[model samples]
Target: MPSQTHPIDPVRYGTEPAAPARPIAAAPSAVLSAVDAHAEAAIALLSDLVAINSINPLFPGIDRAAVIGGETRCTDLLGERLAALGAEIHRVAPDPERTNVVAVLKGAGGGRSLILNGHLDTVAPFTPERWISGDPWKPTLKDGRLYGLGSTDMKGGLVSVVLALQAIRAAGVRLKGDVQVHAVVGEETMSHELGTSAVLEAGFTADAAIVVEPSSQPFPLSVAPVSAGNFNLEITVRGRATHAGNRGAAIRPGGEGASAGVNAVEKAILVVQALQTLEEEWGQTKSHPAFPTGFFSLVPGVFHGDAGVPSVGYMADKATVGYLVWYPPGDTADAVKAEIERHVGHAAALDPWLRENPPMFDWKSNWPVADTAEDHPLVRTLVDARAAVLGPIPRGRRETWSLNAVTDASFLEAKGIPTTVFGPGNLRFAHAVDEHIEIQDLVNGAKVLALAILGWCGVAD
Candidate 1:
């Protein structure tokens, strides 16, 4: 927590002077050699971490103790590694079972500070047998990727940071700016309030941050400066219930058709169809520069309709539909909510039952946008670092790039700490049957991060 401290002797950081270093080319990669030297160590640690089942217990529909609740153990393992590197470690556990680790290797003072963040939790492997890697818990190396449950979704990220820090410490480079390595929990479920946000709420932040969230796919490994906002909406439709035999009576011309009763299932179908038309309209109307055409969407992920019981003999009395919506940056979640309610409200007015008893909305999770300007120093330095290390930047990976999905970067941005999403793992395998991250991606990412640190934090002469 203190902002400034005496400059650590450069010799203490490496075997030689911290020499005026700028890793965007110009400076020798005496420090980066550590990454190559310990490449096997990085892979070993990644394999070890992936072996642990750190599935988030809070994940919906999963509460098995045998497979979940590994956050505290994972956090402890990282703490030990950072401690071995001489960094001061602090552990924050919002839930007694799930702990977050913040390892701060304070700078000697002068340059900006930075935080490298990643989550420790993983989504439960629904069926371990379906995993082509043979076992989701035991990492299998095929070609160049290390396949495991958390490898790509991102235990690989943690490995990259450790490698960078280890390389820096081994090179004996005393940074002018502070570096905070944040290994958190609950990211798979957007529980930032208890994870990333909690770390900041505890006053551990920096001038800028890079969430090592997986960003590969439809493009090579890249840096993303922004992410879209999203929300989980559940719409409940109500209707009158009566005996199934009343269906004919309700529909017959000479029967009590007008006042017999209403079928909630039929009414719910109306709502679904109405929203589909709006979703198609959104495809043509809404657009963001970084996102592909029609990327913003309203997905009906879950639908339920039934009476009080599962019996088909009774007419359904109620129905509920759950939707996941993604909106572009510069837009508020409230605006998106209001738009949906308004669209459905207008459509509801068409039906007698819906007009009388409108659908009730219960908005669940809200993940705000993580928006950072492309011209910011953090962005510029990372771009320069990428160019310096990889050369000939990959296509579509320009500074203004965006992430395919939202991440906890939003929490840091919300706290006024500029943040970006950049990492080694490919998004194609994230949360897939055989999740994995390229071993080369990890090494490349570590090199870039090492370079970024040298430039952004500045080298103490």
Candidate 2:
């Protein structure tokens, strides 16, 4: 669709004198009041969104229909709200089940454009018995907090974006540039592919972006402009099954025993050890100023093997291991891939069996490391806005930080749109049962975001 245009009065968009700058402190009150006026509306929207089971069905045992319904319902609801607020809306669904809601608040067109993006999908509530809150879909508000599966992870943040936009509009502030909000799907499962990444691929652009991803736990008000890149790797080891009692007869060149077969599981153990050592070296030497934990993490999260039928007491012939690798900004996904290949290749050469039947590699779900300079206007705007709303800055808490987990923000960064991750929820609580977000944090986040948008996009009188 073509860019929408609106006629603007000459005083604001043309020769008239520009409005005097308002004190930073004065900015928050109006926006905050507007947000407060709609406080109940925000909470109700969040509660309704949380009640939808938009869990990514890609996880084991999750119902696919639930995920479809969740994404469809949430996106539809957000689209309607945006329309009611008078923003131009676009609904895109690369996958029929997962729709992305893109709402554009067209500005007077003289300032930088801003994009506020958030995901709608949450991870399936696994092992709910561990949840003290009981039902994951039944959202509960208690002691100034809202508890549910997606509340903290992102539904809360999503709500904040909607309300922030509404508050800005309610205050009768017209922006010089456009403000776009993307309510995406499939973040818990694909991070990008079926969500944010797909939206950008379809030709979305902005001067800067703020992903309303949660920032809970140790650093509640922290902003992450830099995030690590990550990908999933699968390693397959081949072996031949053999009987345990055959012994020497099986070892002989012409022997009919299972000794001739190699145990792939045994080979897998060596690979794990080698990779762990590499991970240790990375932890000790590489570090990002913003991301305290350094980079290049290789975690083997899954492993499985198929041994020859136990009835024959034969050795296993095949093994499989799944790994997740997170690399810092300086490390490219290609570099990490090569490093793993080199390590595994060298280890394979050491064993004759592995040399002939080398372990196979399957790399998937790759995303690049995302980093924006500390001084970037968008980062500075948000950092300042956060400080203004939350009070004096703490010594250890800096304006900018990094996230260990990869997010859809990286996709935008790859597109050259400076993006930062900020919002209300804790990453630790995300994907866990009984996930929750503080009501105060949600309100404060909305105020901060509104301030950032007003400053970066430039409000027109």
Candidate 3:
């Protein structure tokens, strides 16, 4: 008789068809049942997390102390739940009050660890009166959507990680490699003092990481590069205080005893006109290769006038202005900065008032780029997992787009970790009235994450 060869089980290197060399020791039924049993608790934890108002300090009246207070509550709650799951937890804080919580779930076998990252802080809730249906702090479930502040932006993603781990624990499904869940603060505002940067410095490393940022429907993962910057300028014109009645005489070169001098506001208009011309020319030339050809944008956001009070007495002293610049992934921050300075310098030389009070420019603080090759094992695994769970992934993609207004992904990416921003929900709803996450999308995200984690750790079945 010929000897027969048996097929190998990918998940468990075992000769027996149903058995593995290293099984969880618990039946599959038992593991799944545990997950099902704890599903309600997992949802409850998310509900509580959303209930806490952890708005960023960039919002009006939010001070450092208030932000810290919110961070403490969020860390405390996550710590309690993670500790119960048998994970070793660490709290790192530059400030005594604000903290970043890290929970490590050790694996039975050694392999590369995966990082599950989420931000605890969110943008401020818009005016309560503006809410269309539910309060920002109080979460409401209606028409299969969970509505609350941070519901889609990220609280939902954080909840999913917690619940997935809980189910794994309850079912006694031993992981092949470790998993680290990091809940961080300071995503909304650009703050170096306390945020993801702090966590990285505290010595947190992972082979790959996922940032649970909000996404549009059909569950598209963001793998595009995003760049942001800031600029400022000032203009001043020379004019003499004079009576309103004498304004016409001031305009005349040599009128009968002209008391009024040149009108400062009039000169300011000329400077603004010159600035607009420069803006149009610069806007057309600048482009980034990684992003769409016209992805570059500039906006004049702030303007200040120095006339003492609103009353029109003498000519205005000066006019100050500030703006923002956004470009595509491959664009260089230093180049953009140089271009801005050059334009401002040119404008100042031409205009006399502007020459006297030249424009001042300041670039936005450095925000690093988070880009990993599409062929990277971690990136490919996530792309495949998302496709399996949510259908065909969206097209026209690069590596890194706007993760949030500005997230620590940039900070962490600087430290040499491949990171991608992925999650469920419409980005439009984030920070808007009646923010929410569709239940189905949230479920799909959790399933996709679990499968991706399995693939990354080489778990097979």
lDDT of each: 0.82, 0.78, 0.63
Query: How much is the lDDT of residue 343 in candidate 2?
Result: 88
lDDT of 2 by residue, 169-284 (tens): 89888889998889998887665777898888877789999998886524574788888888889998988876655535645667753436676777787778778878898888
TM-score-better candidate, 1 vs 3:
1
Per-residue lDDT value at 5 in model 3: 15
lDDT of 3 by residue, 174-258 (tens): 7777888888877776554476778778887788787777644222444433333333333444444455567667665576432
- lDDT for residue 2 in candidate 1, whole number 0-100: 12
TM-score of each: 0.91, 0.88, 0.79
The local distance difference test score of model 3 is: 0.63
After superposing candidate 2, which stretches have Cα over 4 Å from the reference?
A: 1-25, 246-259, 308-312
RMSD of 2: 8.8
Q: Could you arrange the candidates by TM-score from highest to lowest? A: 1, 2, 3
Q: 1 or 3, which is superior by lDDT? A: 1
For candidate 1, lDDT tens digit of each residue in 185-236? 9999999988999999998989999999887744445779888888888999
lDDT of 1: 0.82
